[model samples]
Target chain A: DVKVTQSSRYLVKRTGEKVFLECVQDMDHENMFWYRQDPGLGLRLIYFSYDVKMKEKGDIPEGYSVSREKKERFSLILESASTNQTSMYLCASSLTGEGHNEQFFGPGTRLTVL
Target chain B: LAKTTQPISMDSYEGQEVNITCSHNNIATNDYITWYQQFPSQGPRFIIQGYKTKVTNEVASLFIPADRKSSTLSLPRVSLSDTAVYYCLVGAWEDTPLVFGKGTRLSVIA
Candidate 1:
């Protein structure tokens, strides 16, 4: 079975602080993604990495950045956290684009900004 | 990303078959329809995926028409634990993100 693990399952940060969320997938999938889920708004993509050092902005990329220095690890960073940025962060990975491949997701990290 | 639309919520009793329909009018040629189940405070779990016709797994079945314009997720004899939000996505590109709809919140009653 494919397993995706996140470093922190829950985190709390003060306003204007820097936050880093780490994710690692055991399957060595080529694609990784970060998304923030909110009630009534659904899940909005923040950033995605197709390969090492290659990143792409998703629908909502403001105030969020991602790093993919290695294949198994993907990190989401908030340079300066704000209260409005608090959300449930999900990390997912999949094989290269082809046909219909289901994304394997991590447990998720609930971030609270005060 | 192809657009998808589904009901906001649904209510069903235990042991009943629950079918949720998702409409994707502009699904592309290479696009495939996929369904995910999400529980509160957890990430979405992959349920099923199909390009056309029908695909079935231990958990659920996916039915897609010839036109590839829509898809339906059928849950067989659902149990109380099956209650959760179901999201439908039309995406074949892995790097490309799947657009999630409001999703249908299914409540199972005894």
Candidate 2:
């Protein structure tokens, strides 16, 4: 079984504080993604990395950044947390392939910016 | 990447087959249809994926038509524990990111 673990399940942060959400995958997949789920808006991609030390912006990349210094770990950072930034964050990993590959996701982190 | 559209919500009783359809009018030839099930407070898990025709796994079955414009996910004899939000996604397995729209929220009753 593929296991993806997050650093925190619930986090509360004050406004303008820096927040870091960490994710680690044991499957050794090459693709890692960060997404935020909001009501009615569904899941919006925040950032994704295909390989170590490489990152790409997704649909809603503003107010967020990602770090993939190692192959097994990916971290999402909020330089300055705000009230509107509170949402459920998800991390996923998949293999690098051209066929229909499935992504395994971690238990999400619910961040609340107060 | 192809955008998918599905119903907002659905209700079914235990032991009933639940079939959810997703429409992707502009789906590309290289794109494949995929379904995911997500429970509350948990991340989505992969259910099934298909290119065309039918594909069945232990959990669910995926049916795709010749045109590949639409696909259906069939859940056999669903139970209350199968109740969750189902997302339909279309993308190439390599470079495209799995984009999720507002998924179909399925409520299973006893």
Candidate 3:
């Protein structure tokens, strides 16, 4: 079994405020990802890292950035949060050894920016 | 990642079998179809994955045809807990990242 934990469950922030959402995975998975979930937009990728100190922009990575300092931890940073940036942030980790099918996800942090 | 298309929502009763089909027009030979179930306020969980023919696990079964243009996920004896959004993903080997579709929202009524 894999356990993915997020730092926050609910967050509220005013406009132009900076926010940070953290995620940790107990399983030693090489691939980590960040995604934002909206009502009608579904889940859009923010960023992903295959290895430490490396990052790749996903479909929606304009307002968000990611940091992967260690193997088990992945963090999402919202620089100057806006109302539009308010959404459910999800972090996922996958075992890259040999071949893997699924990416385990965290509980998700719902961030609201007013 | 191959683009996938499934129904927006579905309605089913308890103890009934629900089959959600996904269409992938451009599925490659090496691509595999995977399914994920997601409840409200939670992330998606892996359900099943298959490349060709039938693949069954303890929770669900994945059926794929020979042409590979489409795939079906079968859930038998559904309960109220089965109500969730099910996503269909077709991942290509050469594709770096996996793409998840909008998914089909399943409603299990009593």
Kindly report the docking quality category of candidate 2: medium
Range of the 10 consecutive residues with the lowest summed lDDT in candidate 1 chain B: B92-101
**Candidate 3: segments with Cα more than 4 A from true spot:** none
State which candidate has the highest lDDT. Answer: 2
| Per-candidate chain B TM | 0.96, 0.97, 0.95
State in Å the error of residue B42, model 3: 1.1
If you assessed candidate 1 against the hidden native complex, which CAPRI class would it receive? medium
When only chain A is evaluated, what TM-score does every model earn? 0.96, 0.97, 0.95
lDDT of each: 0.90, 0.93, 0.89
Candidate 1 DockQ, CA atoms? 0.64
- Estimate the TM-score of every prediction: 0.95, 0.97, 0.96
Q: Which candidate leads the pack in DockQ?
A: 2
- Interface RMSD against the true structure, candidate 1: 2.3
Put the candidates in DockQ order, highest first. Answer: 2, 1, 3
lDDT of 2 by residue, B50-69 (tens): 88999999999999999999
In candidate 2, stretches whose alpha carbon ends up further than 4 angstroms from where it belongs are: none
